[model samples]
Target: MLGKLFLLSLVCFFSLNFLSTINAETNLIADEIQSLKVTNKDPRMINFSVSLTEDHNYTSARLFYFLPNPSLNKSATRGDLNGIQSKFNNFYVDFDTNKGITGSRFIPTGVTFEYYWEFTDVNKNNYKTEMQQYLFLDGQYEWKLLTADNIFFYYYGNYNKNIQNCFLESVSVVKDGSDLLAIKVSYPINIIYYLSPSDSRYAKPTRSIVMDSMTVLGGVKYTSNVVHSYDQDCGVVKHEVTHILNEIAGHGTLLKLPFWVDEGFATYMMNKSDYYDNIIEKMINKNTVIRLSSMQGKPGTPEKVNLYYAQSYATTKYMIEQYGLEKYRSFFKILKEDFVIDEALQTVYGHDQDSLYLEWRQHKGLPIIKLVKIEQSSIPIPVATITPLNFPSKTTVNQQEVENNFSKQNNSNELAVSNFEIFINNYIFIIVGAILLLIMIKISIFLWKK
Candidate 1:
């Protein structure tokens, strides 16, 4: 019987173990991912697709992607892939640039995005493809790359003499700017040049922002670290690249310098033409040139726009030429430390914005008008101390009351202790009497037996 019971126990153990193993087992299968492709329909749309070696139904399919640079977060942006029936059994999705995900957003053309695809099978097992990178480009033109140092120039259409000159000069401008600012170009600055002016319509749409009562467009600095240009001049490249270098060097948690300092420095570095030099002088004579402090944005009228740019150029030129590049470098460093523009100027040049403006005007042979400082009157605000009503206060007892309560608790405890002692004494007395009775009965039984 013992042997049969032991055998029965062994059989139950084996059966239970086998069932647990089956429950824990999983089916592992690898899907063959092949022919991954990204097709640019235009700047307005993109198509992404991938093919499978064996046609197997997946419960879910998705594409995950993100731009590594720019302000776009590093976290992946998810895009769902169309069903297997679409595009002849290929997993497919069309990304509309003007609608849905990409939209008319500030996502710059020519920037690269890293992407990968994920698929979940019927059993809920997930499979992910290896990561890949694709550059978003203008599909309207065949692009040719011209790379120098850390600058990547993407130009399209037949190379004209202007294009050649701009490309070569851009290389020199980028190198010189990087050296002058003492900033290492860790990431590539992509310059996408639409050779024909008509091609601008097909290129990525530049978003417009209203500034200073004017809709400002046509600026290449719309996207960070990327330039979309139609100009054939090397000055355009220099001007735009100076903005990029400035951002790379001095931008900290504070994203930008003042508009005048930023735009003026770019114009001065461009060395484009003598046109800006005379525009400011004419505006000064007409007493129409806006103050540098007030020209914090691009102005409304065309004439004011011209004056704004020229004044910025003139002021920045005065700063660098008068105080020297080292002082300007120090000023940039102070700005990087998140100092306000006026404070940075004061720290570096021992002057404020208005003072710099007057100094620049005096140097330009323009009238130096003393700006009236607006002192804001400090108004004392009346503060009300609100005391809440109807709330119960903590209950307080007198010293005599506390003593009386303590005495009562002591009396109760003494009564309980005395009752417990009396019960214990009675129990002992009863137990001793029973023992004596049992001893006498045992003696009587012994005597009778004897």
Candidate 2:
């Protein structure tokens, strides 16, 4: 009897200790933090206000961020979780000076950010806010913000006569596309652009990292730089603005997309059907055309990328012309609604993707793709897993209940992504960006020395 009683007491002790640890968030520690708030004051400054319990013991604070790509993984590029001392000032700690945090790399315009803050106390306890997001833009520069019924445009710079006289050029092209397709350009479209060689306040990484200027692609990031390409200036601008509309249609920038349809449709709308048409016949003849799915999650080399883009343009143009734009637009929306490519094709074209591919090949007078296996390059994409939960015996489980939960529980939200996994995807882009910036910085240093 005494042995059993002693064992019961031992178990009770450990259980109580475990419960204490689990319930600590609500514990009445006098040093507990009371309130935390943050706001983006401007392009260069962020304001924060924090309050703590009467017996607070403050330690330090830090921030982590990334450049917001306009693609599905909006801010895939990660940067240092740089720190800023909170040096107490009355009731708040505001980072508003040049000494705080300011630079083109850290605060580029038109790029969005995914960021979070962490605060640690003297007790070694860490407190953090849920990750928040924002897009940085050149709000300071606004020469004209125009609205043409539903289409819009924002331009800044001295090229008012050169760039703004035909501000409605892209609007006109898309309007033609709308009339042909029997679809509307969802209201309040922002066709933001500037025609200047010295337009520096653009999106990051690609903002300054212009590639092979001999063949300079005419877009600052996602918005076109009109001064670069006079011949196809409107085409470039229309292509990019169409991308913005597509992003909205795809239910924002975070959702995964089939890039073929996305870019292809954009190219068609921009009237760039023959962007890279010269390579298509040769590719089809040599059986080197990339499969449609290859465009997802990974980008290719510059040459190969152009080929893919051309193929995308060709396919989308064919669909729109042959099957009527109304059906094509419905098809695009279904794909946007998260339907698999195969299912989307089947629903729209009365056949699977493979059948659709064959039909497209037939239209092009090329042989049908047979049993050739396309090898997929492995990428470190995280997939969600679930562990079966065990509840108390009193809880009831049923067939329908179990079936409903299988999907929700194993979705991407619950993936086991480590810090390193998140960092790697962002780090590669950062390295490229850093290399470009460093090259310019080195040249500047050399000039200064001279």
Candidate 3:
């Protein structure tokens, strides 16, 4: 009976050990299944799902996932079967992941899933935005598997989300002859297109354009029709850009350049053609005849607006052509310092305001005047003559005086007749005869010893 009891005890011990082994195996399988994990990365906090497919031979696993919006996020979500199903149906992801299950034939070779979530607020009211993410698998004793396919799939989702959020407010395709063009501006700054008709004369506000139709001042991207019949040259846009930059760089604070100078600079930057060159030449020619001082600050008359624009453009062009950009820039700089426009020109060009006009006039072959003066106070007066002792006395009547007088008269007659040619010339005979008579009188008195 004791031997029988020992054999039964040995059988009981073996059965208990078998049961314990089976329980341990089951627990190990459970632990391996629990080790599988999935992750999603997105800029926007969106819900998504990931599914795993296993191979019976433990060779590889398939991951199926879906991304409804790939533009904003870069990740996938994993949860209970029902939650995963809900997200998967809404958002779709491509197969990515290749890992084999351990000890068991089941492996997650790929994932299939979906997501539903909102993206972060990208400040794209006036501009567009873009986004990306990474994913790693936490498996039991699987060396922490990571695959690019999975990560890339999430990136695609983020990309798609951004694409969906991106929307163009207005688009314009302008045709100029053989050229095809398109211009688009996004939301927020929609005022660019809604400029008042009056403003159109001055500037083009930020707005939308279509083919012959325009929607200005709308909250959404304002659009307008392309009016080819009324289309202006692209230079018009340049003019508008200048105004925008001027305002944005610090509006009224810019140096108060004269209207002509300001407008001329804008025109130069906008229109650079032979036509403009001709206009400048005309202005230069006109300026040579007219003083710049006379032109400065002169308001345009009703009929002279076109003339004013042309002349202003010419003057500014001349300045830029003669004085390089450095000096041109300096001109504006000085103007900014609150110098009067004329004063600024004088300071930079090394001439007074009026002188510049004169120089320009001269350069253009215009008439100029010069004056001369004579001084009369620099002449000297003649001196009086001295009388000699032997000179003849006209009132003397003595025999010696008479004889001297008679001899003087005869000598004077002889001396006067000496130059007969002088007598022949009427004027010369009068001058010579008088000189000879005075000499004869002196000689006669000396001969008489008086």
Candidate 4:
């Protein structure tokens, strides 16, 4: 009986010790942090405030935050709170969203951040408050959310047909794209659509032109599975969501997939309209279809932009139709393996860019224009070297004349590009002049009416 009593006492002693250890750890944070609050001061700033318990005195404090990316990983951002304030057992730190004390990367509005506060006591013991989530917004509008198929659409004002269509179409695109590409979208994608173009200050700002005193932003996708747009067009949603899928497929690869492949795939997924079809047909007739090598980047001029998208769509369409989507999928897989466009084409389609272009043209039943066989080099200079090749067409064209005409065409293209650059360089002056002209016209019309 005495032995049993001693064992019971021993058990009670260890249980008390264990309970005390847990209670001490739990109180460490609770005792230091009395209350915590985060406020979105405006579109450009956020204020963090924390009150500590009277028992503990702290000499140092820090705010740590995290921004999650699509790869299921997070980046940590820290701010020193020592100098900001520490009176009445309270601490305050104001973080500038634009400057992003974290780094040079810009953190746009509407992104959710997880943050916590850590305090160092005079005894050098560190205590951290519980993590909390804060949604960064402009705090100027009341927003509403609609969820469908892992997509969250946030908007303000009345729920109109346009928003409904955007929501439904975005859901369909996500489903179809995920199944087609075998990509599982495990996380929710947040899309913030501004109901009024006037409210664009709250949306992600881009380098955009102001036309007719309104901002035009089709759509933009960020690496964190966040999308921002001002329009409710279903086509724009399809295009942007396709880019999200493309990003998922190529995630973790060092080199980015070429612009042609990326944008072309997005365009193809959109299911082109009659206007796009007309553009492709017209470019084919002019024999000005941009070569694959020339399609390394996006075009500058509006006309070239139209031609670029049209031709890219046509090229991607031909590949999927002629060879089959499964083969195209294999090609995409190769591209994800860090192979360049030329090598990926060669491996999957058994041809290079030149041959693929030739075959696509043949598929279109267009007149065969012989492309100069330029020697491949480590660094591709835009200079095209001409080499004569036998043509399948029975009609003989003057080789010398063709070369000379090609040279003139290249020169004319360069001149047009240069002129466009000059126009773009004077963009600010042109905008100011156009605005002045509009104001003058308005005043004249008012006087005439009077």
- The top-ranked prediction according to lDDT is 4
Residue 132: error of model 1 in Å? 0.6
Candidate 2, lDDT over the whole model? 0.48
- Name the lDDT of candidate 4: 0.61
lDDT of 2 at 367: 70
Give the per-residue lDDT of model 3 (tens digit) for 1-450: 554455455445555544443332111122222123334331112223322222111221222222211211222222111222222112222222211211211111122233222111122111101111223222211222112211111111122332221111011111110011111221111112211233222121221122103112111110110110001223433333332222222112323334455445545554555655665566555652233444434233322433554555666667777777667666656655656656677788886545654565565566775323222221222211100001112321000000001001111121212223323542554455455555654554554453
Off by over 4 Å in 4: 1-28, 72-83, 99-104, 206-215, 300-303, 372-450
Q: Give the per-residue lDDT digits (tens) of candidate 2, residues 1-450.
A: 565555455555555544544433332243454655555544345554555554545576555544443333333355434344545411343432122212212333344456655556677555554666754444445546555765556666555454654467666755765565445654444444645333432221221121223133343213211111212266666655555555445432123346666667656776544545655766777877666655553232333555566677778777877988778767767756666666668888886645666688888888765745445433323221111111111221100000011111111122223456776753655555555555655554555555
Candidate 4: the clashing residue pairs are none
lDDT of 1 by residue, 210-328 (tens): 22113212326434456766545566666777777776666646345666776777777777547677776677788776676686444443334566677788888888889898898
Which run of 10 residues does model 3 get worst, by summed lDDT?
397-406
lDDT (0 to 1) per candidate: 0.59, 0.48, 0.31, 0.61
Kindly give the stretch of ten consecutive residues in candidate 2 with the minimal lDDT sum. 397-406
* Candidate 4 per-residue C-alpha lDDT over 1-450 given as tens digits, one digit per residue, 9 for 90 to 100: 565555555555555544443333222545556678887745656788888777877776767665545444433222233425658668877765544222223455557777777776776665677878887766666778899878988888899899898888788888887776677787788777776455755434323232112324455554446666655556766776777777676433455556567677777777655656787788888887877777765454333555666777788878877888788878877777767678789998998888898888888787777888655543323322111111111222101000111112121121212324434642645465555555655555555555
Choose 2 or 4, whichever is better by lDDT. Answer: 4
Could you arrange the candidates by lDDT from highest to lowest? 4, 1, 2, 3
Clashing pairs in 2: 69-74, 77-426, 78-426
Q: Any runs in candidate 2 off by more than 4 Å, and if so which? A: 1-143, 150-152, 159-162, 173-187, 196-198, 201-203, 206-217, 220-232, 250-255, 274-288, 373-450
TM-score comparison, 2 vs 3, better candidate: 2
